[model samples]
Target: MTAGVETQASAKVSAPSASRVRVEAAAPRPNMGWIVPTLYILFLMLPIYWLVNMSFKTNTEITGTFSLWPQNPTLRNYIVIFTDPAWYSGYINSIIYVVMNTVISVAVALPAAYAFSRYRFLGDKHLFFWLLTNRMAPPAVFALPFFQLYSAFGLIDTHIAVALAHCLFNVPLAVWILEGFMSGVPKEIDETAYIDGYSFPRFFARIFVPLIASGIGVAAFFCFMFSWVELLIARTLTTTAAKPIAATMTRTVSASGMDWGVLAAAGVLTIIPGALVIYFVRNYIAKGFALGRV
Candidate 1:
């Protein structure tokens, strides 16, 4: 009897129930969800890849015939950009103003955002709306006004002039973003700091700012990106001394006409700074989007 029971148990273990096998067969395979995003990414990367490919080819190869890859690759385009004073100076000028603008915008926005998040004053909403309106207005509207004003002060072609001009747009955006993050922080922390005899500045600097650091990163990123990319006003307010890379690209014509190779190389170089900024701040930006606590 014991031998019969042991043999029956072994048979049951050796063969899974027909129902279990049917259930396993019925399980759905994973859908190709990755396909759409992969295609979309490829679509976006195509132009960038083409630009890089063209940057290596000579102008003769670019226009003379269409090719996926450079038949005879050369670094002449990149060499020209690095070697030429005018070409390289444009990049320097852009960085000078962009960094200045990001710093100024975030600094100004922090105090204003703190007030908005913590205080409840008359017309606060109205004032905040007015701040956003400045950002909403097209850069073109202020281009002429800024040019005339900067000229009157003899600030044309100066880095500070461009930095200040960008602040008009950047400050409001920074303020809006920082306000949202500040609001997420509980007011109890402020009360606790005060009870410990901490001054407003001391508490803000030592305790409060650290809690909302991600917000600051997000604001600075936007400010840098805006100042780096803005063209019409940057071009209008400057000529030789403070011309940005964007304006320089527009003027990259030679006796043979547009230097396509050089332009492509410059474009590839121009994307590097913004890419680096995003890479460094990517984590902070993610935290900021989640309101730092979510």
Candidate 2:
């Protein structure tokens, strides 16, 4: 009887364990989880690939041939851009204004963001809303005003003009982003710095800035991209000297029809700056998105 009872207990324990093992073994593992991401990447890459392919083909081949790759690849389009002063200068002008805008926007936003995150005052909410409202208005609405304003200041056809104009939108966005990141940091850090006989500017530069470095990166990245790609305001604000690569591309449409190959090459070149910016700040952007800290 004793032996039989022991056998029964062992059987009972082993039965459930064996069943659990079987159930686990029968359970379906994740089936090709990489498929969706792979498909997504391919979808995103297809247009870029087509654009690159088109860049290598002549206008005739581009319009006539339909292929996954260029049938008769040529360097003429890229050569045209590299050799032409107007074409190359447009790229330089774009880089200048974009850099200027990013600097000004981030510099102004840092102090303003610190204020918003650390203090409370009358109309603070209203003030913040007002700043964001500037961002809310369409660029078209501001285009004429910016043109007139820059005209008044003799700032037209200048890189600084475009940079300052872009600040109208970018400053508010930078503030909003930086404020969120600043708020995530503890007030105790500020207080402790004060206790240690650190001056306001010193503490801000040395400690607070590093703490919110990712936010700055994210803000600067956005500012650079917006200033780089924005055509309407940049076009409205400049006619020739400061005209961006985007504006120059529009001129490719001539009496002989569009220079599709050259245009494709220009478009591909335009993507480079934004791609580089993303590569550098990708970590910051990822962290910001994940934690809502930036």
Candidate 3:
């Protein structure tokens, strides 16, 4: 009887201790994971903060001193950008070409990527390398040839000219990214779709496309970014009517003087399309990198 009572007491004591231990173990620890990310975010945002601040200031304030914030904040810069047809037209032109470049790059790249991912043909490896080599070539090397080629084709100074020119680099990059993501998808899915009496085109359009949708988003974002920022080829391809925002920015700085306020405003405006694009694609970026297709 005495031993049984002692054993019960010991068991009761140990059970509470075990439960306490488990409760403690299940609790989250203080992590330093946020430290590096926080610092990196601050670093990236600082330049943007400065640009926005400077945009609000007058030319005198901007030239006079380097202030963290504008002393006398004004919307004149924005007003100028909105009111001027020339300034706004550049934005419109840029949008047209950038969208064209992105659509063409992704549309062409998707099939090429799918081919590379799914099949083995003669010299397929060589072809893939050749396509990627276009990206490796310096843009300067292609500028003169592109100019002459577009001139010959009567595509010079057109949005299509800029869009096609951008494809020289963007298409290669899009293909590579899409190929990586597509390769990660399981081949079983294709087989299953085939066994279910789905036609190749139907299966690819319905099943395969959705599986790698994240990859498509990522490729499109990169294509848009590259084509948007590229100035050399854009300038080379288009003269006035289809001139990109980058070339228009050059007009601000000439032999006479720089239009600081207008330039700042243009710079800020240039960032908007990219920012909105990234915002929309931000969720897919992680999955895109993971190449996680069902």
Candidate 4:
């Protein structure tokens, strides 16, 4: 009787096991998860790939043919960009102002953000909202006003003019970003530093800054991008001496028609600075995003 009972229990267990196996076998398999993302990436890459292809080909070939790849590869487009004063100087001017804007924005924001995060002041919330309002306003709204103001100061057509104008937007954004990161840090840190007889500047530079380095990187990255790609303000404030590559690309017309090859080459070159910035700050930006600190 005990043996028969044991056999019955074994049979019950085996029955479910067999049923589960059969169900799994009959279930439809899922399709590949990567297909959609892969196709989307390829779609986005098409324009950039086409741009690079055109950059390598001569204007005649570019206009006459619609090849996926360059038929007659030539470096003449790149050569002109590198050698020509107008072409290369735009790159230089852009880099100068971008660097300046990044530095100034981050520098100003660090102190302001620290203040906002650490201490309460009169109209602090109102002040913070006002700062955001500046960022929200379009660049075009400020462009003409900036142009006129800079003109009065004889600052138009100068790299500093663009850099400083960019600060009007960048500083507020930097402050907002840095404030969020700073607030995440414990107030005990500041007290601890003060108890150890560390001054504000030294403590901020040595202890506090390192802790929020990711936030600074995120802020600086944004500042660099805005100053780099901005056209209207940069275009309106400068006629020639400080024209960005963005403005230069628009003026690519020649007597022979549009300098399509050189324009394409310039477009390719224009992507490099932003790419470099992204590569450097990608990790920090990722952290900022993950933590919702930005």
Clashes of each: 0, 0, 0, 0
Overall local distance difference test of candidate 3: 0.88
Candidate 3: misplaced stretches above 4 Å?
Answer: 1-30, 254-256, 290-294
Tens-digit lDDT string for candidate 1 (1-294): 557877899887775656646544444788788899999999999999999999999999999999999999999999999999899999999999999999999998999999999999999999999999999989988989998999999999999999999988999999998998898889999999999999999999999899888888888888998899899999999999999988899867888889999999999999999999999998787676554435
Q: Judging by lDDT against the true structure, name the best candidate.
A: 1
Question: What lDDT score belongs to each candidate, Candidate 1 first?
Answer: 0.91, 0.90, 0.88, 0.90
Full-model lDDT, candidate 2: 0.90
**On lDDT, who's better, 1 or 4?**
1
Look at candidate 3 and tell me the lDDT of residue 72. Answer: 92
lDDT of 4 by residue, 1-294 (tens): 557877899887654544335454443677687799999999999999999999999999988888989988999999999999999999999999999999999998999999999999999999999999989989978888998899999998999999999998899999988998898899999999999999989999999999998888888888898889888899999989998888999978989899899999999999998888898877777676543352
Q: What is the C-alpha RMSD of each candidate to the true structure, in Å?
A: 11.8, 10.2, 10.1, 10.7
Q: Which consecutive 10 residues in model 3 have the weakest lDDT in total? A: 18-27
Q: List the residue pairs that clash in candidate 1.
A: none
Candidate 3 per-residue lDDT over residues 118-189, each given as its tens digit: 999999999999998999989899999999999999999899999999999999999999998889888999
**RMSD value for candidate 4:** 10.7
Measured with C-alpha atoms, the lDDT of residue 107 in candidate 3 is 92
Residue 42 miss distance in model 3 (angstroms): 2.0
